[model samples]
Target: MAVIPVAIAGAPYEVRIEAGLLARAGEHCRPFLRKNRVAIVTDENVAAEWQAPVTASFDAVGIASDWLILPPGESTKGWEQLARVVDWLLALEVERKDNIVALGGGVIGDLTGFAASMVKRGCGFIQIPTTLLAQVDSSVGGKTAINTPAGKNLVGAFHQPSLVLADPLALDTLPLRDTRAGYAEVVKYGLIDDAPFFEWCEANGAKLLAGDSAARETAIAKSVAAKARIVAADEKETAGIRALLNLGHTFGHALEAETGFSDRLLHGEGVALGMVLAARFSARQGLMSGQDAGRIVAHMEAVGLPSSLKALGLDCSGRRLSDHMLHDKKMDAGTLPFLLLRGIGETFLAKDVDLNEVAAFLDEELRG
Candidate 1:
């Protein structure tokens, strides 16, 4: 097992990644399971394949577990679904000291963590992220949130988990599309700050996707560690240091909004395409070389990820897409901040950007 510590300002946590870690979640969580009643929140898809092993692990540790299964998709991260989860926790009579275990992907982790944060003022929660996307990105950071009709993650909180148990073995059951989509986030870690890691991905990512255990472990550990360092420096996103972590999120979230946050475009898939766009646009602005942007797109395509909006089958013009970004949370005083790159592994937030120019550039990409 590879353990990475996520050292936030006041709330330091750890993420344990390993093959077959799901079967040992009880043992891993034993230190934090102070209460008898544990709430396991998962979506139907994950519950069908992974619930038994997790439940058995808890049972072996002599803990009583109750589950709340949600529908599988980004749609589950909404007011109604959040309320349902909170109500279920209430029905289970979970106390503030008891734990809520998030047992699915980013949706489950975000919703469950938000629910745990709200109930009884603040409750303890553990993240058992079953998807590669969550394992590397969403599951480590405390940025728990649900999407609103207006935009993605419009409603949420900073509720850090007590612990995160990432079982890479669970990823074996994930669809290839999902696996490829998750790789977008793994690549984001390198793009944000680690040039060597970015180069490593350019070489080893294909092997990682091919089920090479060594490559998978290294990718997960490095990605988690990169996020851990950022969260430690800026836990609440008050400092722009953490905002750099949103390398592709602003554009990606806008794309997600344009799709109505539906399955038509998975969050990771949007980020994959968004990162490519971010690099290309940065190069267009003379912030980076166009050749670097081409390299990024080439790597993404090699991994079977969507490197362009055209690949997503979205027909909207770039002006329409820019309109969606207006609702992004990164907007300050009507000016949206973008994490543009100087080159690979070097991204900085550009606050004085012109949305009209962005729209025109996006229009070019859409038409190209």
Candidate 2:
């Protein structure tokens, strides 16, 4: 097992990554399992595959377990589901000290963490992420949120988990497309600040996706380490350094919004295409070389991820995509800060950017 430490402001924790780690969750989380009652939040799909092993693990530790399974999808991250989870926890009589186990993917982790943050002032929680996206990105950070009708992650909190138990074996049951989609974020870390890692990804990522155990472990460990370093430096995203983590998120989220946050465009797919656009936009502004933009697109295509809006079969022009950006949470005082690139492994936030020009750029891309 590889352990990566995430140092947040008030609370610091470690992310434990290994194949078959789920069977040892109770042992890994022994310190936090003070109360005998444990509430597990998961989706139906995950419960069907992982519930038995996790329950047996708890049983070994003599802890009683109760489960709340929500339907799997972005649509489930709403007030209705949040209310149901909260009520379920209440029905279980969960105490502030008893820990809630988030036993599925990002959606489950976000919703359950938000619920733990709200009910009766707050409670303990652990993240047992099943998906590659959740393991490398969402599960480690304290940014838990549920999607609102207005936009993605509009309602949420910084409820850091007491522990994060990531079992890569859970990913075995994931669809191949889902696995490849999650690799987009894994590649994001390399794009932001590590050129060498980016090159390594271009070479070994295919093997990792092909189920090479060594390759998978290396990718997860490296990605987690990079995220941990960033979180430790800027836990609350107050410093611009942390915003680099949003390298592809701004444009990606807009794409998600345009697609109605459906499976049509997975979050990772949006990020993959967004990173390509960020590179192209930077090159257009003379901030980066066109060669770098081409390289970005090539790498994304190599991984079977989307590199352009057109590639996703979306007929909307860049202007239409820009319209979706108007609702982005990053917009402040009517100005949106964009993370643009100067080269591979080099990105800087452009706070003075004009959205009108961005719209024009998108228009140009669409027309071409």
Candidate 3:
């Protein structure tokens, strides 16, 4: 097992990565099991594959647990589901000290963490992220949120998990498409600040996606370590240091909103294409060399992830897509900051971005 410790000021935590880690989750979480019981929240799809092992782990350790499984999809991250989760936690009579186990993907972790944040003022929770996207990205950050009509993740909080167990074994059950989607995030860490890692990804990403254990473990560990260092530096994103993590999210979330947040474009897929957009847009603005932008797109295409907006076959116009971007959560003082890259490993927030120019760029992309 590889342990990466996240050093947030108020709530430090550890993200553990290993094979078959799900079966020993209770062992890792024994120290934080405050009330001798845990309340688990997951999605229906994960319930069949992961819920049993997790519950059995707790049972073996003499820690009791109850579960509430919600429907699995992007649509489930909204007001209705949030209300249901909170009510169920109330029914479970979860106390402030008890840990709420989020036993699924990003959606489950976000919802469960948000619920724990609100219930009884604030309760502790553990993140047992099953998907690659969740493990490398969402599972570590304290960013918990539910999608709102206004935009994705517009309603949420920064409630860090007490512990995060990223079982690469859990990814064995993921669909190939989901696996590819998750790879976008793993690539993101490299694009943010690690050129050598991006070079390593160019070499080994195929093997990692092919279910090579060593490759997967190395990628997850590096991604988590990068994230932990950044979180420790800027926990709440009050400083712009942590904003680099949003390398692909701004454009990605806009794509998701345009697609109605449906299966047509998974969050990771949107991000994959979004990263391409960010890279190309930077090149367009003369911030980066066109060669670098082409290389980024080539890497994503080679990995079977989306690399262009034109190929996504959306019904919305560029102006319509821009309207969606206007609702992104990263808006600051009425000006949306765009995470643009100057090179493969150099990402910086451009606060003076012109949305009109962004609309025009989307128009060109849509025209293609």
Candidate 4:
């Protein structure tokens, strides 16, 4: 087991990456088991596979849990589910001091954390992220959100988890598609600040997805530590430091919006293509070599990730796509900051981006 500390101001937390932690979840959660009961919010898919081991673990420690399972999908991250989660927690009488357990993927963790944030103004929550994407990114960051008709994650909160138990073994059950999606975010950490880590991912991502326990653990630990350090420095994204984490999010979110935030493109898939776009766009701006941009795209392709806008088969104009950026939460002072790369491991925020130019670029990409 490895512990990565997130030193968020006024609320510190730890992310535990280990194998088989699910079976012993109760032991680790004992210290925070204030009510001898926990409210768990998960999706049907996760419950079907993991509910038994998780429930048995908590039951073994004499901790009771009120389980709320919703349908599994990106669509579940919305107002309806958010309301459902809040009502369930309220019915369970979960107090502000009580900790809710988020036991699933990113959608579950985000919705549950958002629910915990609003219920009684703020209840604690623990993350037992069962997916690779959730384990390395959504579960550790305090950023919890639900999507609205307006945009993805437009309605959300920054509710930090009191404890995060990331069991790589949980990923063993993930479908190859989901595992590949999660690997996109894992690669994001390397692109944002660690060139060597990116190289490591390019080499070992396949093995990790193939259920290499050692590779999985190493990726999770490294990714969590990078996120922990970034979250600690700028938890609220006030100083733009945390914005580094959004390396591929802008382009990815636009792709998500284009796809109606559906199964057509998973969040991490959009990010995979988004990072490629960011890299290519950086080259467009003369900040980097086209060869470097190609390298980024090549890596994604080799790893079975969507590597270009052309590959997604969307029927939309670049202007229409760039229009979605207008709704991005990162827009500030009437301009959105594009996270562009000077090269792998060197990402910077470009606040001077012209949406019109972005529209033109997207149009070209569509034509390509």
TM per model? 0.98, 0.97, 0.98, 0.99
lDDT of 4 by residue, 226-277 (tens): 9999989899999989999999899999999999898999999999999998
Model 3: how far residue 232 lies from native, Å: 1.0
Task: Compose the digit string of candidate 3's lDDT tens values, residues 33-76.
Answer: 87778888999999989778888899889898888999999889
Looking at model 3, the pairs that clash are none
Overall lDDT per candidate, in order of appearance? 0.89, 0.87, 0.91, 0.91
Model 4 spans with C-alpha error above 4 angstroms: none
What ranking of all candidate models by TM-score puts the best one first?
4, 3, 1, 2
Clashes of 3: 0
Off by over 4 Å in 2: none
Better of 2 and 4 by lDDT: 4
Which model, 1 or 2, shows the larger TM-score? Answer: 1
The per-residue C-alpha lDDT of model 4 at residue 222 equals 96
TM-score of 2: 0.97
lDDT of 2 by residue, 1-368 (tens): 89888878678888989898998877777779877768899999999998899888888888878888889988888999999999999888888888899998889989999999988899989999999899888887788898887889887888889999988888889998888888998999989999999999999989988888888888889998999999889877878788898888888998898899999999888898889889998999999999989988998888799886665666787777887877777777887889999899998889988777888887776665
Better of 1 and 3 by lDDT: 3
Candidate 2 displacement at residue 348 in angstroms: 1.1
